[model samples]
Target chain A: MSAKEYRFRLFVAGNEPNSRLAEQNLRALCQEYLPDRYDIEVVDVLTDFEAALDSNVMIAPTVVMEAPRSVTLFGTLANKAAVISALAL
Target chain B: MVENQLPNIRKCHTRIEGLDQILQGGLPTGRTTLMIGGPGSGKSLFGLEFLYRSALAGEPGIFISFEERADSLKNNAATLGWQLAPMEQAGKLFLLEGRIDPRAVITGDFGIQSFFAILDHKLKAMGAKRVVIDALDVLMRLINDSRREQDELVALHQWLAERDVTALLTVKAPREGQLERNYDFLDYLADCVIQLDNRMLGQLSTRRLRVVKYRGSGFGSNEYPFVIGSPGITLLPISEVGLSHQALGDRVSTGLTALDDLIGGGFRRASSVLITGGTGTGKTTLCSVMAQMACARNEKVLYISFEESEAALVSAMRSSGTDLSSTLALGQLRLLSAMPEAMGAEQHLVRTLVLIKQMQPSFVIIESASACKRMGTEQAAFEYLMRLINTCKEMGITVVTTNQTAGLHNLDEISGIGISSLIDTVIQLRLLEENAFLRRKLLVMKSRGSSHSHSVHDFAITDQGVVILQKAD
Candidate 1:
């Protein structure tokens, strides 16, 4: 809905299974869905916990999207259908 | 009964009134304590009090609430006159509202790793030694999977154990709706488990606390009654004071010379006295005279009038020609009158306890026990008087209580409360018919360790005061 590029920030606890899978799946989903129109920043809470805390991240693999509208979602992001609808992809 | 704590476990004093005594010293330092209770059972308040007190004691603390907002917790603490903002401002405390968003879409798996990461950062930033995770079940319910809940609980336990921070996790006890998945693992994980109960005894509401299990530590397992008064929570064990009573002290006058002579010299100082009589048998008049005489001795007296108002008692004393103005002005006497039905039984008991603690009076005169029965059941009145008399005796304060009976025929019954054994002296008053006129009589029924007169003495309510006719017809 927006003419600007989609901005996505994902919060994760370093190298956890769901965190790793979520990172891989989000990049894959982005490459497939909106190749050059998105920006991705991954925060490993193990190192940069202040960012997680400031963003009110409660769990690992929490994705905050500032795209068409601002929203936050969390989990492994394996259910691509729910993520697409939630992120308005 | 008090237990000696083993030296292996160090205690972090909760500083809750009377709770440290129940926990021996306090909860085990650096160990998890699981609090299980139903809704409105005061688990959150307990956790809040612990954190507030910890901060006050120079031990930094943190609170993570999964079910309630931090603002609400602050509001609750504010009710108890605790300022959490200042504590937070000083970096002595941290409050995190960790309630998960209800609309969040879950795709795959989630765990406590992120939560611990943030909590670790916050704990390190504040250097908190105590932590409270309220409504841990709320977080668990979000995970939904029983296996995940178990692993996550174990992860929490190990995390707390490895760190120096002591933690208390509040869990809502599962009720009838749940057929499976009880948190038996909590007992295996936590070093201590405290249970709280909120029950109603007929018309009276009562709250209680009990320590279910305390590993490697001495604890009081008995359920102790508690009241949530102004200071948050006060656990009344009905003990501590009752356990340290000395023998009665020297003699004190009962105001009337004839009455004094009848009970040997007089009522013993620090002794408990009970006066039983019918409606028109002058129980209140006796209390008034005793209160006035005690004050006349320059002793501080506390008069609790349950049957009459303060103004009514003052007026009655004035009508009887015994002026209490000097004693009242000099602060030698304090007259407090509350209607028997004004407060709950527990409230009445706590208020009386508070009054006694504040006034530290040498004498306490309860106008009548029957009116106190109106506060609650007969058993409640019994406990009320029993605690009052026991506490007074322990503090070496002389207590005089009156109980109104049905009539003159039941003089032997000692009215309704049946605490005769606790009374050091018992005085009986009765009405008699002589010469086609009603006559008042007084008898020293029983005085322990003192020889008392068995003969019934004729007494008259003179305009001046009660006069025991020693040799009159």
Candidate 2:
């Protein structure tokens, strides 16, 4: 039997207000809504700025939900309900 | 002793009190400064104030705005209280607004050479010493190639520098990057860089200006908070000093003795008094009474009615028994009626300043400042109003502005846009329904530099105008 699991990675630039808020929001959603079903990776672009640039991340606090290919979303993570729904978790 | 050497080189004076100190002697003369900021940071206003002050110094200036139409710019400037139309007519100030297509430039249909030629001709024709290019970002967007954009900017800067013209270029900071990253190119090219920032402090949004770089001159590097007030923008560099009280001893009677008594004699000259009330609270009637009082003293008065026409204002004042017809006939009272949407906020400001200059009035009244919000941009409208108020104060004119508060019971709604902070004297009028009858009450919230009676006076608008009733002790 095979289970369909989802994987997500949030690329953030340093610990800016927008970036920190996005990471906190995404982790909270994974714990409460998608517990035991998804793997979450939080990447700080400040430490790995080159990787963020190579991934074509023009803006910070970007959430990339990877099922097969990466579906990237940019903007502040202030909208928790919308982000959770958008990632289909 | 023979003094051959000149005293210290003096910085160009803006002529507006308190602003020169913040600029550390008024925007580096004969150099281009880029003012970059987000919306509501007062970039356009900074440019307008620079030109207005230069014009007052007998230095002809030109304002080239791409974001706003010509008439709109005029209106907004008028609202800020800088009269630019007359200056334009007298060849002291010039305004140029036109459309440029980026695609056409990319296709080689539009040449940058022609643009410079046109600008040079206008500058020479007007003999303009100062030039303001509002929103350089808009112009950059019209050029498809990055190299061409950079070349055009550099060329323009060099051309202005060669002509010995001090120019002001305004740009919008990118929404998502640090200040250094957002305006890297502009910061590199400009001789001076001024950044206007609006930040939310608790519940209030404060506007602060910082001089990031000034090539060869000493300037104030600390953030200076500024308030857009009557007469124009005044930077508060020294907050410990209170000067709003330093004004000529003059007063205008408030028609109603009871209300006048509450104000301690009457409204002080050069003071900004705000009359806020709910609907049908006689705010307009009270303003008319003050206008009539000013005109009765043989002093010239300028009345800006935003919600009513000249004919309607005259009729309303006439019905209230304040004979404004004779004042109009004698050229003592000039009524300028404007529909908020008739022109942009900047244009409105320019017109108001023009009227003030033309009439040389000692008193000015803006009936219903709330209507100004209905114009193109609310931030522009507020900025213009503040500037206009500041200008009036500088001219030693008593300014009585009326604002209609939203929500019948919410004082918070009245405080929206931070208008209360700009006012020197606040007269709040509330409407109460008692036994199915509406009663209007006026309360003096605070008056600077004067001991005002803290009493809520009952007032009524009849054919004889506004009558203040004795409050029950």
Candidate 3:
């Protein structure tokens, strides 16, 4: 809404199938929707366990839309319609 | 029952000093203990302390919280002087935050298998011997259905038992008779059940803990008062045990020579002496005289004054030609001045015990008993006084107290809860009407283990503090 770049953070547990799938799905969704207007950051909870607490992520493979309004999606983020509608992408 | 011949049962020391004593050494090991209490009743504090202390004792622990986040849990523990973050990093303790919002929980035929698996992983990863599940009610509510709740609870208890880890689960209790459905189920599932209560009588609040059930073990089945204070929770099991103090034979002086002669010599060492009198009858003066004599013998005397300040008492004694300041300066006398309305009866008892243990005084004088009457109800004041006397007698400390009667006419009145029998010696002071003038007289009412003169002598307050005009005839 403010013409600022969109920021996304994906929390994963180090190379698990669901973690990799969530990362891949979020990147594809971001590329198709925002293209060059969004930035994606991947955090491995297995290395920085305290980061999970900082981000308020209870489940692994969680996608957080940190910009305008802040939304959380749990699971593999493969449902593009649900993710887009929930995040207002 | 004989103490030496008791059966041997394995127990994991709770690491809480007084609580372990109340539990008869410790809680039964490898069993689930359900701690139920209302809000602010210290359930979380107790559970956290158990895990923290066990971890400090060389046993790893896991704290699985379903109510608070790991960061908030760390902050709360920090307030109690427990450095939980370092322990978490050192692998000695593991904190798992598994809190789920109630509205977001979809309860369609779901169970707690996944949650149990998570706990299992964490426990196995750390090799923790102690585990705490704080606020199990949150997870219980997530189960929604009753059958799943029961199955999950039973399985969780069994899982902890199988791994031989002592688990503590905290649950919130409902108001008086409105027991929750899950609470009833968990009560039966846990091997031991402890109930913590915070009760408000009028304006003061008291925390108490009771063990409702302890399987295959013997414990003090009485409600013990606990305070969540500086270090952690401390339980005061006052009346759980019987009295076992040894009596002494040596006698100590009462300071006044004529009064001593009337009481057959002096007071028995380690005996509780009570002085009861009406206003203006010089009861406190007599106690001051006895305290002076004890200090003169180069013995430490602890004088607890509720009605007067130390400076006022010292000035008054100085005016009576008694040099109390010298004894105070020589470290033979310590004066503690406190108002009865300032603290509750339990606080007074704990403070008195702490001072007695630290000072090791030979004589303890509570200046006026009427002030203690204002602390609480008559029963509370009586119990506190009894415990004080019992503790002092156990350590061979001479106890003396002064009480106020109703009037000058009723010389036989034993005021302030009527604890005449609890005392070893009772002296009654009264103002007798004589020739349009009032004269103070002292009478020996009861003296245990010794015969005393029954005659009354004129008691007077002069420059020498307390002076007996006539000898016992």
- Every candidate's DockQ is 0.63, 0.01, 0.14
DockQ of 1: 0.63
Tens-place lDDT per residue, model 1, A4-89, is: 48888888889888989998999999999989888888899888977877766778888878675787777889899989998877
lDDT pick, better of 1 and 2:
1
The TM-scores, one per candidate, come to: 0.91, 0.49, 0.82
Best-to-worst DockQ order? 1, 3, 2
Q: Model 2 over residues B300-375: C-alpha lDDT tens digits?
A: 9888988999888888778877778888888898889888877656556656776787789988898877887765
State the lDDT at B70 in candidate 2. Answer: 72
Relative to the true structure, candidate 1 reaches a TM of 0.91
Write one digit per residue (lDDT tens) for candidate 1, span B383-451. Answer: 788888888888999999998887744534684477786788888888888899998988788898899
Interface root mean square deviation of every model, in Å? 1.4, 17.9, 6.4
Candidate 3 local lDDT, B115-193, one digit each (tens):
5545666777788778888898877775567787888888888888899988889998888888588887888888789
Candidate 3 positional error at A19, Å: 11
Candidate 2 ranges with C-alpha deviation above 4 Å: A1-89, B1-213, B218-245, B248-251, B376-378, B408-412, B447-456
Local error of candidate 2 at residue A69 (angstroms): 59
